[model samples]
Each structure stands twice: as C-alpha cells, then as structure tokens.
Target: MTNLLRWTTPDLALTFVLDDGPVRLIAVREASQPRGGEPDPSQPLVEVAAVGHGHSSNRHAGTVLGRQLRYARHDETETTLRIVQEELTTGLRVTSVFEARAGVRAWTEASIIGPGSLELTNLSSLVIGLASIDAELYSAANSWMAENRWSKRVLRDVLADIVRDPHHHVANSRHAVTGTNSWSTGETLPVGVLVDRSTPYALGWQIEHNGPWHYEFGENRRGGYLLLSGPTDHEHQWSVEITAGKPFTTVPVSLVVGTDVDSVFAALTRQRRAIRTRRPIDDRMPVVFNDFMNTLRGDPTTEKLLPLIDAAAEVGADYFCVDAGWYAEGDWWNTVGAWEPSTTRFPNGLAEVINRIHQHRMVPGIWLEPEVIGVRSPIADELPDDAFLTRHGKRVAENGRYLLDLRSPAARKHLDTTVDRLVDEFGIGFFKFDNNTMTGPGTDKGGTSLGHGLLEHNRALLSWLDAIQERHPDLLIENCASGAMRMDYAMLSRLHLQSTSDQEHPLLYAPISAAAPAAVLPEQAGNWAYPITGTTREEFTFALVNGIPGRLYLSGHLNRMTPAELDLVRSALTAHRAVLDDLHTLVPAWPLGLPMWTDDWIALALNGVDVSYLTLWHRAPGPSTITLPIPRSKIAPHFPTDLGDWTYAWNDDALVINANTPEPAARVLRLE
Candidate 1:
C-alpha cells in the first residue's frame, strides 16, 4: 500500500507517497486542488544513483514508481517533514526533507547503513514532475552588468523534438540550463518557472546554492520533469564517497505553485524572508554613500574625503564606505593581499578620514576582497601552499590573483584576522565583500574531486561568515562579486545587502535596477545613484530615481554639485527615508512590465498594503504617456515635487503618467 504524506501553506500544497518503492512526488498544486489526478506516475520526488566498485553494481534510479524499497520511519513538524526509505538490495537510505510555508523547501540526504561504502553520483536536490503537457518556461539569463534578463518560452520549443508518437522505447533528451564555478549566477539565475498555458497555474523555484548548480527540463512518460541539482560529475567533476556511518545532503531548493507569476513571486518573496538569518540592520534600510561610483573612483585621500564625508552626512546618509584602492599607493590591483593603510594616500592615516565620517553621525565602512591573494603580495609567500586553491599541486591563479581555500584553517585565520582588525581598529560597522576573479572549476586538494572540493570550500566560506556574524551581531555585510555575479540566494540569505550592478551610465543602469527585484528582495537591492556635475536637472532626476525604490547607494561628486543639484540629492534622500519603513513589508511588481536591455521606458512598483511606490524612467524617444497596470487612484509626485512641468492623469483602470520632457527623464510617484 502507498502511504501518502502532505505539506501545505495557505495557498500551496505538496503531496508525496511512500510505498515499497522510492518516495515520489504525487502532487503539487493550490490548496483547493485535488491530488495528482493525472495518469502518469513515473517521476520521483528526488533522484539518486549509486556507482559501486563493479559494473554490475551501478543502478540508474528515477521516480520510485516502479522500484522496490522499504519505508523506515518518518518525522514531522509544523513546517517541516522528513521521511526515510531504504533500498531493497543496497541498504542505502534516502532521507527527503520538506518544509512548507509560503513555498516548499526540499532536499535529499543519502546515507549508507550497511557495511560497504557507496559511491554516490548524479544526485539532485529536487525533481518536480508536471503533468501539464503544454507548459511554458520562464527563467532569467544573468551576466555582468546585465543581470536578471528574463525570457519566456514554451516547453514544446525545447522538449517537442524528444517527445515522439508511440515508440515506447524512444530515448528522452534533456535540455539543461547549468552554471559552473563559485560564480553560480554568472551565466543564468538559479531560478525557473513552469506555467501551464491552458490554465492559470505555475510552478516556480530557486536552486539555493552558491557554487556550481544544474537544472534541466525533459519529457518523461508522465508529461515532463524538472531536475534541480548541485555540482555533477559531468559538469564539475563532482562525486562523493559515502561510508556506512556518514550521510551526504544536497543544497536546498525552493518550490512554489500559484495561479499566476505574480502570486508565485509573492510566495517566493515571503520564502526569502523566512529563510534569511534576520538582523536588526535589515529592519533599518540605511542609506549608504560610497566614494567609488563616479566620485573618487577608489582613490580616496584624507584631503579628498573630508568634503565628501561632510556632503554625505549633510544629505542624511547613514553609512559612508571607502571603496577600493583605499589601502593602495599607485599600482594596487596585483598587490592587494595585505590590507593596510597607505602612507601616501592618507598622510594622517585612514583613521582620520573614518573619524570624520563618524563625527557626522554616519557609520564608517570599507571594501575588502577577501577571497583572493594577490600574486605580488608578501602574504602569498607567507601562507602555506595548502592555504590556496591548488589543482594538481599547482596553485590556481586567475586575473593575477590566487584563490584562497576557505576550507584551509590558515586561510580562514588570515581572513578572520583581517576582518577583526578592521572592525576593532576603525569601529567599522559595514564591509563590502567583493569577489572579482573566478577560480575555474575547483581545487584538487583534500582528497576530493575538483567540484566536490569547491562545494566544501563554498560551504566553509558560509560557515566562516556565520562565525563573523556571531561575533559582531550588529555588523552589516554587502555581498558583491564585481556587482552581483554571485547573487544567488545562498549568499543573499546571510548577507545584508546585494549590489545590483556595476554599470556606470545612469541611463543604462535604470533597466538593471528596475529588474533587480525579480531576483533580490526590494530592501536588499543596492541601486547606485551617481549624479555627476554639469548634467541637466532631468539627468540628475534620472540618476536619483534609480535608488528611490530600493536601497539608495549614493555616489557622484556631491561635494562639487551646485546648490540646485545638491537640493535634488537631498530631496531624493528625504523621499527614500520616508518610505524606508514601509518598504520592509512591500513586494515588487512590474506595471509597464519587466525592462528589456533597450527598452524606451521602464517601470517598477513596490506594492505595499494600502499604498504603493512607483518609479518610471524614459530612456529613449517614445510616447509621452505610459499606462500603468494599477487601477485609477489618487497619484502624487513622491520626489522632486517641484517639477512643475511633469503631470499625470488616472483613468478608470489605468494611471497614465506623462513625461513632458524628452528621453532620459524619470519620475517617482506615490499611488493610493
């Protein structure tokens, strides 16, 4: 007899069945829907394989629909469920855990209970099979300065060729979207949505891993299946040897089902907050002013920073960060391992500049690239070979820097000392941890495969960060990999903020900022607002508008701006502070729809309970008015209310805002 177990949220439900075979996902639907009434049942909840010492021992496993197994035991909590099952012949126990809330978080653990060791290969965190035959897929293709570029495609486009009439023995081909190395989000986001065309149902999920991950969609006898996994042997040379007493667990993956994309995204937003290790600073989304963007450009001197610090504090900025090159002399990229105060840049020491920032009631912060040791730095020779990532006994160097293996005690100690010294010596309350280089596949040390070693190292890095947070409970950290190259939830779940982009052009950055909420939470999205001198008032408004809906990361030469430009900056800051408290409970939506790389106009709305904030930018010549999706309501200009030329009109079901000016203009509005 098949025993059925269930987990559900107010809007979603997931059902699993345990029988004399492997555990299988029976149904995933809205709370009011029936169980998997579909006919197909070959898909399993999780997939695993055991590669033994001999060829005869290899077993290819899929859905537990046909295989024979024995149910061991089960455990349950209000929000979580765990079930254990043992293979009939191999004695391998597979434990699957499911957590329910706004979404379902699930993962699989493999353990060998018998005497012999087992080689595990091709393990997936979760495999969700959809019975809907004509489903459309939605996923984002991300890259540097071009993050969160989403596209929608029909399942038939990718799986149609493999689904034949009635061959019975036809082979199934898989269409995979995979990413490699520590920059898990460098190529594509670890998220996807499968929506049925005929119905208002969709399944969305995010693979929560910071390192290499793989997700694929293929046609199965039971409609189609989606596989979410970590590093695999074929992609990352990854495999693990599980002993009798040890257990291996894959990274977590989240699943949510709803009637449409908006509802699914809303559930995901709640899931993101639920899984995060909350901190006090998250509640207070402070405005940060960094000297790197269009300002000092990382060449901060005591003389150059004093006026900027005053300007930043005058504008009500809460934190001031001294970006890169703060500790370097001239050519500092390759000699950046030893983070020390430069005698030339700071004649009175970096402490003097930081103290000035403190005098203005702003917290002092600095940038640190903690994962790499420069090739020319003395620390490269000071640390042992084991401290650095090695491939075949040779240190792996990329972009003139050697990647540090956080798994090494020596490397962890070094980073700990550096972070501690900065916090203790300078009263630093924030640190921007940036990674600029990628370490190919992974390391070959520690008696593990290259991909396995990288996985362990990534896990160790997270553990080290947890220790740091434990010591400094109030400290805030911003996760940046050359501006969001590693913007997966695995890192954002622990970090306080996410740097949205590195694109310097204010016009080009508008779309990136508008689309950021699709991948990151609104309060955590760090959008840069750098208004340079000599630009028009519209241009200044364009720059400031980018930061209004999210964390306003102020930049530009504010100290050199005229009184009018300065007032514009202060006005944006005032508006941002007014909405900071309300932003905590708001979820994001696209009214004019998701921005394209070359869209003429972009729109983003932070939808709150009774009120909402909307930001619109016109980048190219187009229609003077763009209709919004929200209903007709009272609308007011939120920022730069003094712009007398701009106007808006709300019809029955649409709010049309007209940008009286030409292209490269923006406005922030409050809708009720």
Candidate 2:
C-alpha cells in the first residue's frame, strides 16, 4: 500500500490518504533534523516506531505525551496547527485548524523540560474554566438527574469512579462528544456541526473512556506517553516512550481545533451544563478542627480552641468542621449509639461549647468515621454479620479498625441514623468525610459481576446519601478522601465543599486553588489557610482573601499572635465576607503565577463592575514598586451617577485601580 502521507509544503504541511493500517508524514526540516525519512519521492518527516501485536488479549497498550516544540520565527499574524484524518463513514479527508491563544517560554538545560518539570502555559484566552479533571470522556451517566431525581450518591460515585480511573477514557470521554460550538442557524442537535473538521489532528491524548465500556477489556487503566493541555500554567506535558529495536525519532502531527473550539467549550460550560457534573467553584479556607480528645486536650483549654475558632469566624468562614480524634479513645472507637462528649476536652459538655460557637455567630460542624468500628469496641460485636465488608470470608485489617462495608442496607441505615443524630444532637452544619481509600468493592447482591465489586459499594453509598439528605436538606458535606481522592461533581451537589490534597503546605494548594474554579463550586474550593512563617500575614491574607471564597480555618497552631497580625487576618477575612454576602455574580477568579516564585504565592479576585482586581500576595517582596496594568474598560467614567437626588458610583472605561500597602494589608482600589 502507498504511504498514507504525501508531502505538502515540503515538511511544513502533510496530506494523509485514508485507507488502513499505516499512515505516513513528510517533514520540513530534513537536514537540521535527521529523521529516518530520506530523499525519496517524498522525504519523510520522522518515522514513528510501530509495533504489531501478535495476538488480541489486549497487550500492546501505551500513550503519547505532549511534545515541547520550538518553531522558527515567522511573520504570521496567527499561529496554527492543522489536523487531517479520515471519517470512518465516507473516507473523506477531515481537516481542522487550531489557532493559538496563550503559551509560554522558559530556559532549559538540554531544551527538553526534564521529567515532570514546570513552566506550563495555555493560550490565555479561555472562554470558560472547568473544575477538576472530570472530562465527560472519562465520566458516564447511569441516571439523568431530572428523571431519577439525581441522587447525590450516584453522582459522587460516578465522579469518584472517574477520578480513580483518570486517563482510561481520555480519547472517548462522554464530555468530549458534548457540544463544543454554536448552532448553524436552526439546527437540531450539536452533532451535525462536526461534518467537516473532524480531522486526525484531533488531540492525540484522550482523557475519556473511548474504547470499551467496562474496565475488563483494560477499560479503566490510565497513563501513557501522553500530552496534557491546560496543565502547568497553560503548557502541554507530552510524554513519548523511547525503547530499543525501535530507535526513537521524530513524527509529524498537528493539533487542530475547528476555530470555534473555545466558543463551543464556553457554551457547554454555560448553557449545556449537566446538573450531575462537577462544580466550578469559588475558593474557600480549609479549617482543620480536631476530632480526637488527646489532640484538642493538647491545648489544655477548650476555651483556647475558642480563640482559633473565633479567628476563623472573624475571617468569615461559613462553617468550621472539626476534624477527627475528638471522642475519648474508648468512646470514639466503638460507640455509635453512645456518642457522648469527650469529658476531658469539653469539661463543660458539648452543648455549652456549641452554644459558645453560636454566640460567636458561626456555624458549628464536626467529623465522623461511621463506617468503621474498633475491634475492641462493643458496637463491632453488636453489628449484624452482613454489616461488615469481608473478602474471602475475612475482613481487611489496617491499624486495628474493623471496616464496615457500606454496601449493606443495615450499614447505611446505621450511618443515616448517626447523621440525623449529629445534626439533631449537635446542630452540626458541615460534615467532612475522610477515609484512606475504600475497603473491598461490595457484595454480589446487585447482579454482581466479578471485578466490578465497587459497583455495589458505590450504589450502597449513594443509597445512604439519599437517606441522609432526606433528613438534612441543606446538609453541607465536604469530600476529604485523603485530599481530593473523592472529588467529583456528583458529590458536589450534596457536599458543600472539598478538601483537596492531604498535603497542606500553602504552596502545595496553589494548583488546587487555581484549577478548582474551572470545575468545583466557589465555596467548595479548598483554600487551605496555613501558618505563615516568613511571609507577612497581610500578603498571606491578601492571597487567601482574593484567591478563595471559602472558609477560614487554621492549622499548625499560631496560638499566640501579635495584635496587629490578628487584625490583619481579621481584616482579610472581613473582606472575604463582604464579597460572599454580596456575590452579585462570580465572574471568574483568574490565576497569576508570574515571576515564578513559590517563596511568595498569590491568588487574584476580579470585580468586572469595579473594573478592578483584588490581589493577594503571600510574601512581601523586598520593598519595590510593581506596576500592574488592569483593564481601563473595568472603570466607570462618571464620578458618581445621580439617581434622583442620591449619588452612586460605578466602574467604567475611565477608571483604574491601584494600591500601595505596608507589609500586611488587604487593600481595595478604585482604578485611579
């Protein structure tokens, strides 16, 4: 068979013939880059190594990572990549061209950004931002929310499943097939629009479930020599494997979008939003309140906990969910019906402490590990035989806890009764769900097929969610599966927030804070408020206040604080409340991580009305004047528009905002 490719523009462009097994590419720089293709009828661009799978038990599986490329300078108004592939139906050449919007430049040792290096970029003009890596390609919908009344469990389970299997369906994620463009006048569905531009230049990496439905045919596996876009500051991370017998060379391909890729994506995020999808969030503070008695008693005074909680409240935290380890070791480990206050930590009893929190004018919340019971505890002995999840007639043991397989109706009923008890007993506003991973998938009850045990487990958890939400309508749940393991939109609808990444260093949360806006809800984004060491609280506060619209909880004990510093945190939090209370509309929180410094971090908030941006810097740069250009269109021309006899101000084209502050201040500017 003739090579599928023909040289077009020498190596600058290639034309591919669509028939069968192998395709060819013609290169532009044959001399500078010596690829295997020689001076023939068509000099080859680069010969990509191939493999022939001798059999079909699904063996030879791999992926392509994004490539780091530097192009020769050209005097062109636009940068583009053209993709050409064939349509399976008609064997016609499908072509598409993608225009560049944002990209980056950085210094490299050997010109290849070494293993897992940073300095990433994407074309700056994104029409919409998504939350998390929940691409439709990877997620599948078993029930339509409108028809099934959309249970929180199903949504969360699907998302959790998707997160667990992140890359398995990249090429065929359901979301990938969703509409990505506007209508052709009065066209019916969005599928008709892809007639022409569905070319091979389609991104090589797929984050969706494309090949098989079930995980059995290697369906749920993810990882490859892949390419990732919208990762690491807008850059694509390409991974290509080099092996023996197939000496690695170069290959020519293009990244083609149908010019309207951004517009189509924006429409999907806005008009075509699926309710069961993950949320695009506003950032919030992560308050790590302790649940263990010994941990809180370490502070010696429950009242000392008051100051920290008070600090969080002053910063406008919506609800503070106390974390694990609160009950007495004997009481917490085994008791479900006998959940009494830890006498040592709360000598005054639980009600009094909760009342004190009420006086502080903040919501009180707590954590629970209901699915497990200490082996020594009486409850474990009391539970029915089916209440526990066991494999091969034995329970999975870790650190001396008997795991309750949530699959059982009795197990869920027990948890449901406890959720009711917590809210009824303590007036708890938030519940932070934490676990390592999961026990076994579940039983063979619901038409259980082998290797799909989690099917029943996930279904059981969703069943429990239905019961819990019925008792608690506005119950705010936080998904904390060791930091973002359970982050999925299915849970987002029921859960108020999420704690991303078990890692809590302020710098570590930057990406979570950055990417969350595109997917999770504003309040759900876990903006961890870590103890600042060298950085000014003002800078830290600035970053926190502007970056996230979440809660304010502290970690690592800054028990003693200077009056000035406390006030700075208080002031920053106060600013957060004013915005939260008024949240006219969340335009979008944009990211700015330039000057590439992690020693100091920052997150920005934008108010299109004020036509200004609120900047939060984590560390004070040694005194220097930094001039940032904010858009002039964001400002209002009129000093104050007269409404009858009253005067009011609005930002318009004429306004500009700027600020100069002493080390620790959260400053607001009306573009001067």
Candidate 3:
C-alpha cells in the first residue's frame, strides 16, 4: 500500500504518496473534485540538481529518488511536512519542506555533511508535475509605463516538435521566463498560471524573491513539470560553495491549484495576505496630496508650498507631501546627499513649512531617495569606499549617483540618522521612499559574486526598512521606483503604498490606473489626479476620476484654480472617502475585460458585498458606450455630480452607458 500524506483547506487539497522508493505528488484538486484518486508515480516531490569538481547530479539524480532516510510532520492549523534524504556516495543531505495553508509553499535545503565541498550549478526552489500536456501558459509582460500586460499561449505552440511513433522517447522542451538584477519586476512580474485547456484545473505560482529569479515549464516523460528558482550562474553569475556542516536554502515559492483563473487569483490573494507583515497604520488608508504632478514639479519653495498646503487641507486631503528638490539648491539632482534643508529654498527653516502643514491639520511628509549617494555631494568623499557598492575596486555610479550598500554599518548609520532627525525634528509622519536609479548587475564588495552581493543588499534594504518602521510606528512609507518600475510584491508586501504611475498625460494615464488593481491592492494603489489650469471640464473630470477608485493621490495647483474647479476636486475627494470603507474588502474585477494599451473606453469595477464602484473613461473622438458585465440595478454618479449630463440604460444582462460628451471624458458611478 502507498503511504500517503494529505493536507486540505476548505477549497483546495494536496496529497503526497510515499511508495517505499520516492515521494511523489499524487493529487492536487479543488473542492469540486473527488478525493483519493490514483497517484502518478513518475515524478518526485522535489527536484534538485548539483555539480561539483566534474561530478554532477541532475534533478532526476537526487537522493530522494533512491530512498527516503526519515520523514516527520508538524501540525498547527497549517501543515508542514519535513522529509530528509541522504546521498550515500556523496554524503549530501537534502531536506524538503512543504507548508500548506490556503495554498502550498515549498522549498529545499542542501547540506554537505562530509569533508568535501559541493558546487551547485542548478537548483530549483519548487517543482510540481501535473498530468496534463494540453495546457496554456499565462504570464504578465511588464515594463516602466506599460505594466502588467498579460499574454497567453498554448503549451504546444512553444513545445518542440517530436515524432510520436511509439519507437523512441522524446526529450522534454523547456520554456523559461527570467528576471535579472535588483529590480525584481523590471522586466516581467514574478507570476505565472498554467491552465489545462481540456479540463477545469489550473495551477498558479509566484517566486517570492526580491532579486534575480526565474520560472520555467517543461514537458516530462509522464506529463509536464513547473520549475521555480532564484538566481543562477549563467544568468546573474551566481554560485556558492557549500563547505562541510553548512546548508544552503533556495528561495521560497507559492503554489495553488484552482478550477479557473478567478479561483486561482482568489487563492493567490489569500496567500499574499497570509505572508504579509502586520502593520498598525494599514487600516487608515488616507488620501494623500502630493505637490509634484503639474504643480511644483519637484521645485518646491517656501512661496510655492505654503499656499498649496493650505489649499490641500481645504480640499480634505489627509496627508500633504512635498516631493523632491526640497533639500537642495539650484541644479541639485547630482548634489543630493546630506539631506539638509536648503537654505535658499526656505529663508527661515523647513520647520516653518512643517508647522504650517500641521496647523492645517494634515500629516507632514517629504520625499527621500535613501539608496543612492549623489556623486557631487561632499558626504560622498567623507564615507569610505566600502560604504558604497563596488564593482572592481571602484564605486559603481549610475546617472551621477552611487548606490549605498546597506550591509555596511556606516551606510546604515548614515540613513538612520537622517531619517530619525527628520522625524524627530520636523515632526514628519510620512515618507516617500523613492529609488530613481537601478544598479546594473550587482556589487563585488566582499569577494562575492555580483548577483550574490545584490541579493544580500536587497535583503539588507528590507531589514533597514523594518528597523525604521519599528522606530517610528506611526510613519507611512510610499514605495516608488521611478513610478512602479520595481513594483513587485516583495516591496509592496512591506511598504504602505505603491505609486502606480508617473505618466504626465492625463488621458494616457487612464488605462494604467484602470489596470493597476491586477498588480496591487485597491487600498494600497496610489493613483495621481493632476488636473491642470487649461484643461476642459471634461478633461478635468477625466483626471480626477482616475484617482477615485484607489487612494486619491491629489495633485495639480488647487490654490491657482477657479472656484468651480476647486469644487470638482473637493467633490471627488468627498465621494472617495464615502466609499473608502467598502474598498478595504472589495476585490477588483475588470467588467469590460482588462484594458488594452490604447483602449478607447476603459472600465474598472471594485466588487463589494453590498455595492460596487466603477470608474469609466472615454478617450476616443467618436461616440462610444460600454456595456458592463453585471446586471444594472441602480446607477448614480458618485463624484463631480455637476459634470455635463450623460445617458444610460439597463440592457438584458449588462449595464450600458453612454458618456455623450466630447473626447477625454470620464465618470465615477456607484452600482447597487
């Protein structure tokens, strides 16, 4: 009889069978499927391949395939399975750990117990084999402005062709998606979903590494396999020597099985919340007014900011932030270290501005790019070379800024002093932590590989953030990497808010704000609303509607606007706050499907328990109307009720609406 280990949640179940030789995944199904089906014995539970000094052990050659030395299980609401396997010849011990919550998270640790060292050429964090060859792969292709562009293709389309004459076995074809360097989501998001075309089963997984990582799918002899991993030698020049009594742990990866795409996303959402770090200020979800877009444009002075702060508070903004250029004089981008208050920008001291912001009853915030030291700053020479990231005995500079190595004590001390002084002296409550530049591959400071150095620095950066938050528990941090370039869950899971985009054009930014919920939570998404002076009423409404569905990051020169324009801004903020409670529990759904790069009409609906909120935009010059996915019950304008009139009707199974206005128009509606 096959000894099987089982773990189940309310909607998902996973089973592993140990058949005396190796442990293999027997079943992974949703609630609709029956339990205890026949187990597939072709593939093992964990696949680990390594090579050392001309000796190589491929994934299929791991000791787990020979015989399991011992096994144990731990139960505490969630289930954890620990299996230990030993290679008798090499004296290598491999421990596989599987944690089951709403989904399954697995990883492996390879330890050298003998006198010889081992070099790992290839290592996978997790691998799961499925019984389906007819599957379609789905992944998001992301970039700076065009983020989360998902595409799908069949497995056979990219598979290698082979003759199936029943005479010889065909080699498996591998298809991989990889991201290099420190920007985790610089190229593609660390997410993928595989759906069985012929059945209702789908498998999804995400690599939770902040540095370089890769995931691939390949055909095996039985069916197919999915492999997820972190950095490797060929890609990021990563490798580590395992000495005696030392063990190496790979990156963590999460896996979930569901009946369809929606179910897969639901499982992922639960898993994301399960792993997120707890914070106190997450429940507030305040509206922020930033003086960046179309206002000061990073050139804030005493004269330009005091009026804006008063105007922001008058319009019901909870937090008022003064963006970049507050700490420097003229041409200050390359001379930005030290973070001292500019003597020229503020005649008295920055304290006057902070006091004025507090008098207006708004939280005072400032912009900080903490990871880089300016090349022309005097502080650059004061710090030792080890304080910055080095390549080959020289500091690595990008765009006239040197990257700070958080692993160094001197670097951490400098940042802690700067942040603590700002909070204590200025009474600051919010910080916009911006990373404007990217250090290419990695650093080589401590006789380590560039990839390994970058991995350490990334982890160290998170640790520094934890320290800062612990010190100032009331402070909120906005994660901005030139506006969502490094916008991955690794940062979002810890940071308080995510700046969705920096696109200047209001009409072009509509689709970006509409599609942001797929990558970030609604309450954490910070979408900008920058309505300039010369835009039409429709265009002004278009810009203001972009920020209503998410956290309304208010911008533009409200102090210089007309009374009518100011009323529109206030109306939008009022409507946003009215529905803020529902947004906490709402899940995003694309009613008209996900927006295209240049869709004429774009829509995003946040489905809640009692009511749903929808934001619609019309960008084309011709007449157009969108039919939503849900049945029309009652539709009312939730924001800027004074806009030009529109028309709507309840179709059979969808809600149809016509903007009836000219180009570049939008509306925010409440559906009940």
Runs off by more than 4 Å, candidate 3? 20-22, 37-43, 53-79, 100-102, 164-166, 169-171, 243-245, 642-645
What's model 1's TM-score? 0.96
Task: For each candidate, give its TM-score against the true structure.
Answer: 0.96, 0.52, 0.92
Model 1 clash pairs are: 20-69, 44-63
lDDT of each: 0.82, 0.37, 0.78
Q: Arrange candidates, best lDDT first.
A: 1, 3, 2
Model 1 score (lDDT):
0.82
Task: Please provide, for model 3 over 14-101, each residue's C-alpha lDDT reduced to its tens digit, 9 standing for 90 to 100.
Answer: 7776655556665777745776655474566655544532223222323232334333333335567666656656666667777775
On TM-score, the leading prediction is 1
Per-candidate RMSD vs. true structure? 2.4, 17.6, 3.0
Q: CA lDDT of 460 in candidate 1?
A: 91
What digit string (tens of lDDT, one per residue) describes model 1 on residues 337-384?
A: 889999999998999999998899899999999999999999999999
Between prediction 2 and prediction 3, the one with superior TM-score is: 3
Please give the lDDT score at residue 614 for candidate 3.
Answer: 81
Order the numbered candidates by TM-score, best leading.
Answer: 1, 3, 2
Instruction: State residue 395's C-alpha deviation in candidate 3, in Å.
Output: 2.0
Candidate 2 residue lDDT tens string, 1-672: 443333222212323322232122222221123344322221111111112211222211121111112112112223444433322221122222323321111011111222222211111111111112222221111111000010111112233344444445433221112211000001111111111133211111111110011110111232111111111110111122222221111111111121232222222222112222222222233343432221242232366666666665554455655665455544444343334457777778767767766777667777666656666667677777577766556655445676676777677777777778879988887777665424432333333322223333444565576567666765666665545444443345455566644444444344344434333444455555554534664445544443334443344343455666555555555554554543323433433421122424344444444443344343443332333333443322121111112122334422222223434333333232
Model 3: lowest-lDDT 10 consecutive positions:
53-62
